[model samples]
Target chain A: MTAALEARGLRREFGHVRALDGADFDIEPGEVVALIGDNGAGKSTLVKALSGSLAIDSGELYSDGKRVTIDSPAAARALGIETVYQDLALAPHLDPVQNMYLGREVMRSGLLGKLGFMDHAEMKEKTQRAFADLGATVRDFTAPVGAMSGGQRQQIAVARAAAWASRVIFLDEPTAALGVVQTRNVLDLIRRVRDRGIAVVLISHSMPHVIEVADRIQVLRLGRRVATYDAKQTSMEELVGAMTGAISQEEAA
Target chain B: MTTATEPDRDAAAVDEEKPKSTLQRLVGAQAFQILGVLLILIVLFSIAEPDAFLSINNFRNVVVNVSILAIIGVGMTFVIITGGIDLSVGSVLVFSGVVAAKTMEALGGQGVGVSIVGALAACGSGTLWGLFNGVVVARLKVPPLIVTLGTLGMALGAAQILTGGIDLRGAPTVLTDTIGFGRLFGQIPYLSLIALAVIVIGAVILHRTRFGRYTYAVGSNDEAARRVGVRADRHLILVYTLAGFCAGLAGILNLAFFSSTTIAGQSNTALNVIAGVVIGGTSLFGGIGTIAGTVIGLFIPAVLQNGFVIMGVQPFWQQVVVGAFLIAAVYVDQVRRAAASRGASTRRSLFSRFSRPQGARRKEAQ
Candidate 1:
């Protein structure tokens, strides 16, 4: 089967620092692939390149085995790719319905739509459905998202991605600030997203989470993919060793 | 993976039991509270001067006097909601009126045709200034306060140079007859009617449209808006331009009502409008406000001045009172923001019993 998304030889530089040095990545359709690394290991840079948020000096991207170029976030979105950045990227002052339909508001029918009027009813109904489908419990439909709990916000971010993303969704440390219950919800959310037949790229530091939700794990070290392992077969110690550059699968081979 | 469990039943039950009564909602609105303050002032003034302050004529005069400021306030509301300020509105109004008055004079007719051209000239000039403000603030990322301040000086200076420090007079007689003073059913001033139309349209656009939503989103979190594919820069530019457009419209209205450009007047225009917008409940921090709040905010001062004059109080006291109101409004906003950040409900503690359900309390405890 064609990979949902594949990146080849991606390179990015910030003055003297080469953030993404010849990084390669691949994820099959409907698979949950965890990208793990220590600080400054280029995991984020690689995701940025693929998501079209960062410029890649040199790289080849393929969506569904077809060569493509994604120069902007809009372009990546056009290819059915979405990213939940660490910041959650939610307009806190807006309610979930507003934030969910921020750029892509559903316009009212006829002349009103032409006049730029939004159909709040339609948007609200759809947003409600999306949350219900994701099993995310949002208490107030009218309150600003900023007033919500961290877990609720995380669910919003993830559910928003799941609603729009058809090909792949990239999540950056989705559970970083979440508590135990919230973390469970997010992990369950990831599985639900994967079940929808969309590829999920989870970037996380938690080895247990990676092993739990990810079908495969890709380890990055020094701006490059250093190891790929079957998550079910891999040990946390081995994954840590690969991330910290203490183990080389190539050398072992 | 385990199937998604239901949300806590207590929380769900509490959410379903929320009060849906109109009175409950009205009491919760920021605008309603400001309106209450306005009503109290009106009542006090009436009690003090039943014959003068309580008359229909006095109310008409007050509304008519504020019509131009109301128009400008609508635009200011949009700007402030976008996390920006436009200090050049007063100057821009002067500049646009000058241009419109000049256009009508050159056309040399008191006919409706001349009025049409003059109105367009005013709106066009205002749009240009707005466009300029938008470009500088959005493209160059200059702080809006400084940028508008710079334009305030530049626009006023430019107006002075164009007219040689003299106010332009001679708006078309037809415009001054119809739009300026003409009223429906001989009761409402045409100026107030026009102001009403502008306010209604502004409210609708701000509350019901995608553009308005983007305005709030941009103010709330610009980076988030950008990430979601909103051209935040373009939107900011549009918002500033809209403010300019309103000022321009106000300029034409000013000419109609005053029969002159009033270039030397309006020194307090921008400040008064900004204060009214804030007093009405729109935040300086952006992301939260309403046109209703701004309308009430503008009225607080207008009514104070009108009522004070009839009550034999020095009208200058209106300024002091309005200043107090502005500070109080902002203080209230800050307190509410502090509560919201702390995850407490925005409703006052008295109303919190009705608003926050048991589920919310349990969640907070956790």
Candidate 2:
């Protein structure tokens, strides 16, 4: 099957540092591909390129074998790409329902809705259902997100992307600041998203988490794809070696 | 597997939930506090001057007097809600009033229909200036305060240039007398009624519509709103334009009520409107506020000024008292925000604490 998203020869430079250097990555439908790398491994750069947050100097992106151009974040969203950045980018003072329906609010069906009135009930119900499907509990539906715990806030961010994204969802360091329970919740949420048939690109620094959730793992070393491994087939030692440039693919085999 | 301590633990859980509800309930309770203050002021004034303060005519006078400021307050609410300040509202108001008076004069200001056309021109002029401010602020990426300040000077200067530093007089009698002083159904002053209608519409737009949702979202975090495919730039422009439209509406009201452009040094006008919005519980930091709160905020000053005048207090004291309330309102908001955040942290710690196992579970948890 053709991959849902494919990027080849993606190159970006910040002054002299080639943040992304000829990096190639792809994710198939119904796939949870964890993009892993060390501190400066260009994992985030590649995600930004695919999500249309950053401009690339040279690259070819293919969506289901059809090459496409993503010049802006809006363009990327138009092509069904949604990103949950590390910051989560949520309005702190808004409630879960409001945050979930932030940009793409559901309008009422009649004249009032046509005149830009919101369907608050539908938006709330949908948000509640999304949280329910993820098995996540938002203790107070009306509380501002700033008042939510790190994990609950993370869930809202993921749930928001899940609600709107049809093809690809990129989560950039979703659990970097979350505690153990919250991390598990997010990982479980990611798995459920994959089961929903939307491809998920999880960027993380945690090796165990990458192995625990990712069906396919792609390692980036200094702005280049170093190795790819199946979660069931690969060992942690090999994954670490691939990330740190200590072992080559020949030796890993 | 209910332990002997299960019931007690459930009680503990309920006890723990007490603070969370308190935090969520702050918004409703805060509105009540403002209302209480308003009530106390009204009662004290009514008791002090039973004949004057309690009279229906005096009450109507206060309402009509506040109508102009209230109209401007509506637009300022939108501007401030988006985490922006429009220092040009006063200038914009004067400019639109002048434009209306000029339009009426040129169109043979004789009938009510001609006055209506002039009012439309005033609104258009105000919206045009507001759109200009929006473009300079949004497209050019200039700060709102600076852009509005620039427009503030330009608008007032243009108004002065139009009438040669004189207030334009001779507006159509329909505007000054018929709509200005005439009662609606022989009860409500038309000017005051229009202001009330504007407030109702503003409330519905701010509280019940997608535009209001976006306004709050943009105020809270414009970048986040943009990331979610909201054309935040366009929204900012629209918001400023709305604010300008309100200023225009206020200008029309001023023209009718005062029977002229009434242009002068209006530096205090913007400050008063902004003060009212902030006092109403709309945060200066943005993303949190309500229309009802703004009405109360504006009314406090109106009541104080009217009551103080009746009770033989100086007019300057009104400013001092209103200024104090502005600071007090913001301080209360800050305290509530701090407590809410504290509640969130406490809840988080409690969740982790309860989830952690006796001793062995803790070690194996992460």
Candidate 3:
């Protein structure tokens, strides 16, 4: 299958340190690709470049075999690329429905919408359905997300991406701050998102989670794609060895 | 995860309770706290001085007295909700007032017609100043507090220069008699009516429109807003400009009500308006508030001042009481924030402490 997203020769430098050095990566439609690496492996840098949150010093990004430039988060979103960041993804003061439709509001038709009035009921119903479909129970739709459990907040963040992401979704350590149960919920949610035919790129430090959900594993070491493995065939020891440079791919082969 | 399970019946009972309805939730909201306080204050004052404090004349007096402050406080609510401050509102009010007075004086003093023209001029000038502030803070990326502080001095200095430090009086009696003291159907003062209209309109714009959502979003988390394609800079500009326009309206009201621009030590007006907004429970940190709360907040000070004067208490004591209330309001806000975060964590701990349910475990094991 043709890859939905591909990045070639991604290079970014921060004066003395090279954050990203010619990283090459790709993800296919309906595939879960876990981008894993040790600290300073440039996993975050590559994710930022792909999500249009940062500019690579040199790189080529392609969507469906066509060259594309994502200059800003909005540009990435226009191409159906959405990201659930580590934090600051939702306004704490707003409700789930409000947070879900923050920028992409549905306006009421005729004079009311022309006057900039939001169709709140419609948005709320859709947001409720999205949460239910994701198997997440949001007890209070009116309470501020800040007042909700961390897992519920994560669910809203993921559901927001699922609703808008048509081409690719980047989840950046989505469960880093969550508990084990919440992490499991997020992993299950990821599988559901993948089953819906959208490409998912998960940036995670949890090895078990990466192994459990990812269809393909892409390991980055020192700002470059060191290896890609089929999840069913690869071993955690081999992946960790590639990340820490303990064993060479040639030796493993 | 199974090792962490705690079979607590109380926790299960807590989980089985039904969620609150919209009305029930609203009644318990942070914004309604001041409404209760206001009602209590009204009861106490009426008992203390029945003839004076509860009289119709005193009621109209207090309402009219707070109209200008309430008008400016409405805009301040929006600004504070967006995590910004506009210190120049008072100076802008004076500048716009002066502009209205001068425009009327220069327009042959033809009563209400010329006064209308002068009001438009005042609003336009105030809006321009607000737009300047918005552009400086949004496009140039200067901090809002500093940008507004600088404009404050400039606006006040311009007003002083325009009038040579002298109060401008004597425009037209019709302007004062109709707009200043006029009543709507002989029941409500025009000023009070205008303030009511502004409050109603402001509430709609804030709670019903897309612009209102952007205001809360930008204030709560600006980076998140930008990430979601909200033009934060543009929203900032719109917020500042709306504030300026409100100040301008307040300026015209000042001109009409007083028939003069008193440039003597009016710098504290902005602080008073901000105090009212804060007292209404709009967080200084941003992303929370209601126009109704602000109206109640403005009335608190107005009622206290009026009641004190009638009860033979010193006027200075009003300031002390208002200052105390402002601190109390903010303290309550901080307390609520702490409770909210704690509530979230406690719920999560309960969920995790219980581990997976039996049905989920069977599915997972399979």
lDDT of each: 0.88, 0.85, 0.85
Model 3 lDDT on a 0 to 1 scale? 0.85
CAPRI accuracy category, model 1:
acceptable
Tens digits of per-residue lDDT, candidate 2, B6-102, equal 3333322322332257654553444556877899999999999999999999999889888889888888888888999999999999999999988
**lDDT of residue B279 for candidate 2:** 86
Deviation (Å) of B309 in candidate 3: 1.6
List runs of model 2 lying over 4 Å from the truth. A233-236, A250-253, B1-29, B339-366
- Best-to-worst ranking by DockQ: 3, 1, 2
State how far residue A11 of model 1 sits from its true place (Å): 2.2
Report the Cα lDDT for residue B317, model 3: 95
Candidate 3, residues A123-233, lDDT tens digits: the string is 999989988887765667887887766777888899999999999999999878666566677788999998889999999988888888999999999888888888888
The docking category that best describes candidate 3 is acceptable
DockQ of each: 0.45, 0.44, 0.47
Estimate the Cα RMSD of every predicted model relative to the unseen true structure: 3.8, 5.9, 5.4
| Clashing pairs for predicted structure model 2, backbone only | none
Candidate 1 segments exceeding 4 Å error: A251-253, B1-26, B347-366
Model 2 docking grade: acceptable
